[model samples]
Target chain A: MSVVSDRVTALVPSQWWQRSHELLSRVFEDDRRLLALCLTPALALYVLVAILPMVWAFNLSLYEVSTLNPVWEWTGPGRLLDIVASGTFQAAFGRSLVFGFGSVAFQIVVGVSLALLVNREFKGAVLARALALLPYMVPAVAIGMVGQFMLNAQYGIINLVLIRVGILNNPVAFLGLPETAMATVMVVGSWKFAVFVTLLTLARLQSIPENFYEGATMCGANAYQKFRDVTLPRIKNVILIAALLRTLWMFNKFDIIYIMTRGGPGETTTTIPLHAYEVAFNQYRLGEAAGIAALMFVFLALWSIVYFRVARPEEEVRVA
Target chain B: MTDIQVDTLRKEFSSDGGEIVAVDDVSFTVEDGEFVCIVGPSGCGKTTLLRCIAGLEHPTSGEITLGGEAVTDVPPQNRNLAFVFQDITLYPHMKVWENIAYPLKLDGVGADTRYERAQEVADTIQIGELLDKYPGELSGGQQQRVAIGRSIIRSPRAYLLDEPMSDLDAKLKKEMRVELQRIQQQVGGTMVYVTHDQEEAMTLSDRMIVMDDGEIQQFGSPQRVYHEPNNVFVSQFIGSPEINLLPATCRDGATVAVDDTDWRVDTGVDADSVPESVTLGFRPRHTTVERTADPDGIGGEVALVEAVGDENILYIDSEVGELRAVADIEQNPIEEGDSVAIGVERAYLFDAETGETVATSRRHGDRSEDQVEA
Candidate 1:
């Protein structure tokens, strides 16, 4: 009985050999390992420039760092709690939500309207479509400077036109005022992103089958009925995907807002990204900045999961 | 039910190359509850004519009256005509029942009634089990049945079927032909069917119109069209294996010379009335095969024999031209290369210049003879 058991045991691979074989096969068959080998240097550079700094900022957020001493001390979540309870951070957070949602709504409405206008064949449609995308292509810094010059209270073109037309007795201080600063940011953001939405909606519109419309017509559906029954349902999934993508992109937008409002005359246009930058570099409160960075990371991660769930159908079809 | 009358309809399309006349001066009338089958070759404007009747297309010059009211500007939905396209244009997204009930729903019929009617039609077409299945999930024949049911449920002024069974397999097509005829009879609705298959036209139509090059060649009962073609084209286009047209010179009243051989025909044309040069058209079944070595009889060497179950088609190479003769399978086992004589019992004499029948008087006499024989 012992000899037979020994013989059966001998047929099985030894533990060390099995482990080595598995390791080798895993290295051979694993796609992630292959990808990592190809992209390791670029990924490392990205981590160093972007991700590692974010991590360092998060670590510092848990510590009390003074710019004068250039030394840090562990403070845990106390600073984060204090910042959350403060009025300034709360106002900034509230304003960011308004800015994001307001801009996105405006962009979607205007963009869809523009897309519908150019969807049909018309005279000069090509030229009009090209011109519509020009605003999105302008450099963010240049747009900001130009906007500031145009809206300048003293002698800006907008003020000059208003004064000359007798619409205003005096030049309006547009950007300097609290009520108008956030509105200005939203308008600027919408101007930059509306073109993106238009392009996306146009592409989706073009992909709808012409036969569906013909079928609707044959079924005695009028124009509005056809759009409601056929066109809307057919493009619903694409619109959802476009909206989700735009949401993510708009949520993290920094350059347009920073260049335009610089966190506003009051903190009216200070989004989470602008707030983080101010805390870290401007105030030199690395620890608090790191905490804010980590919070922003969590918010973006939640958003990404929601976006993936919403946009999965489009991605799946593209993969197929 | 309303009768349809199309008066001198004409339609021309402006193509990139030039103008194309799709339908030229076509005129026909479908009496109430009549089944008219339009038979033509592909691209011969049969479908274009049906579309005009359905109000899917407007004639460039002409008027269509339904129930004595001009319907030139009426839309398809208002025309009360249901069309079954050749491609089985069932809505892929809709279930079989939904597709059938679509017309009822469009007319704002109640759900309970539409559902009951859809079920009845589904059962009629033997697609009751597939009522809940989307069109994409159904087979080609099932989809075609659904399309037919959709048209039938409307009970419109007329049902226009454009080669609806052309996409089905041979066995299915034969089955559907019988089913369509049965349904048309049961419904007692005006039906205008279009097909290139003469056999289908013969089986389904109360009256069949043979068209060619956007022109109506002949229109009459299928039996009349088959037995008495108005021109050589109708005679050739309407029969399987096609009718044999042999070049002949009318030598006298009772005879025509086919090549060097003098074949006796019962054309009944007087010597003066017979054209000098004419075409002798006879169907394959009309040409009888005899084991004769007579020099005066038309002679041919058998080229091939096609045994089609009940009959044998003998392809013979004659001096007049190649001819086919259908014979009983049990008799006349003439093999290839065998010399034989083919005799014409009755043949059509068509004027070579105009292709019009020169032997109409003979056809009239034959009809009376046939009646007396019956």
Candidate 2:
């Protein structure tokens, strides 16, 4: 199909698409109109599949609907407002703030340390770095299964080990109680996502020249001084972008928490995404679920905009 | 003021599991308030020697003394010295003021004092208006100035610069050479500069060390090193439009026969030390070319003529080999395929096998090493 489109574009020599071509050529050079023409099929497919479903869901949010029986009652945004005022959403929203920020903070701390460790040329450094990427590469379901196995109340490895170590009298119902459930899920979420931040920070670390460290040494900066003066300021932007991305991802993340605690013994671990999923699938409240998802989209968009405005690099962005 | 004395310094680096010696047994002294340049072709241990003195690289087996105190075990930070790297090492995240204030900051200076010193240095470098801009925002030349500013912000015992102006364009490099010399004189501190370009070395240094193959070829004032090169390597490495070499046999104490023509050679050497065949070395400026061949002159055919602003270098294929001779274009008019007679006005005679200097011209004034200072 691409070959056919290429041939067709080559056969047609017209100036009708000049304006849009000029606009695209400003972004990236050469073959602007034909490249845009080639992108049409993928754009159409996305509109049909991903985009159309989101638009349809947004449309459905203004009406009362049920999936169990084919009934659509005209509600005029009343159902959406009702969900917004509901106590379940309020509790879930509070829990999500704890989980999203909490997990993102954990990921940032762990990822930066890991990146710093692996950036040096130590023996077995490559193997150590590759091993650090395991959690991110493993399937979320497998991770959840491992978490369940280790945290089982009756006869789990964690309980047995804690008893032997004498740090805890027992395992203390790790994934089974309201107090520990969210924390447990956050641990699992952070472990899975931290490697991505490490990758980003590591790439940035590699680009920083060796001369900066040498310069600092010649200037009489000790090890700690060098890290504080040279290394930290250089990677500050990467760290900020990494933290922001992790926050965004952690907010929308559902599978790890859902399978690990299933939104917990109470709904203590029910973040906004998990709450929307439970509403749509468990209670068959399609309209309410769509409304919750739409709220999440708007909140994330606003947060991203505010975060960027506060933390964006002050220099004009140039292609590296 | 401090003087640096490096004694038989050696450095070996392992590459791909095999050890290679970078700096061989080398020794030299940089006198206080003097500017010394270590000049050589790339990979000739000039940079390595500078680094060892700066305490950036540890010598395999040797000693370096600053102000008569041995610093073999000192780390870079503990050593009272500053080194400017070849590539600009300005902190990209730092503004020019912060970059220049870095060495003072290491000494735990107060913020007010640090800024004061940084401003003074910036004004000295004529970069006062650029203090607030980040290093990344500055041009390459400006960044280099900031790097140099950082080095000089604190008064170290000596300054070691590793080709700091190598990355600039040619015009900027020429300008900075004179500026660096002026700065050196103003500060009156010992400075050890390393560069691969002989032109920069001769222009900027009070004394120059010509090095090759991890060893010092000659160390003296730029004029002495240029005029009385100790060996063939020094002779060839220190000059532009490279000096010509013709195989000759010593006939007596003052005359050498070159291609059946006798040229006068003066030296302090007794006739007993003179060898039979001496490889003759003479600068291009001393070779005179005439359009007609004579019995007393060496004849050659003109190969190529290169006009370089004020002078022309004629590459002539003569009986000995190809010889490069500097000519005034207006005075000595010749072109390709023109047969010319080459007259030798001045020359040095080195033993053919050992390449050690056997004779030199009386034009060099005196053969004593101290003549470099005179």
Instruction: Note the Cα lDDT for every prediction shown.
Output: 0.79, 0.84
Off-target runs (Cα >4 Å) in candidate 1 are: A1-215, A255-269, A273-320, B108-113, B258-274, B290-301, B317-322, B360-374
Tens digit of per-residue lDDT, candidate 2, span A1-320: 99999988788775656767877777565576678888999999999998998888888888778986687877776776788799999899999999999999999899988999999988898898888877788898998889888888887788889889998985678898998888888997788788988888888888777877888999999999998987787678888888888888889998988888888788889899999999899999888888999888878989999999999834332211
In terms of docking quality, how is candidate 2 classified? acceptable
The candidate that achieves the highest lDDT relative to the unseen native structure: 2
**lDDT tens string, model 2, B172-218?**
99878877887787777899999999989999888999989898888
Q: DockQ of every model listed?
A: 0.14, 0.39
User: Residue B27 lDDT in model 1?
Assistant: 83
Per-residue error (Å), model 1, residue B131: 2.6
Model 2 TM-score relative to the real fold: 0.89
How many clashes in each candidate?
3, 0
Estimate candidate 1's alpha-carbon lDDT, on a 0 to 1 scale.
0.79
> What digit string (tens of lDDT, one per residue) describes model 1 on residues B307-343?
8988888898877778888877777766777777777
TM-score of each: 0.76, 0.89
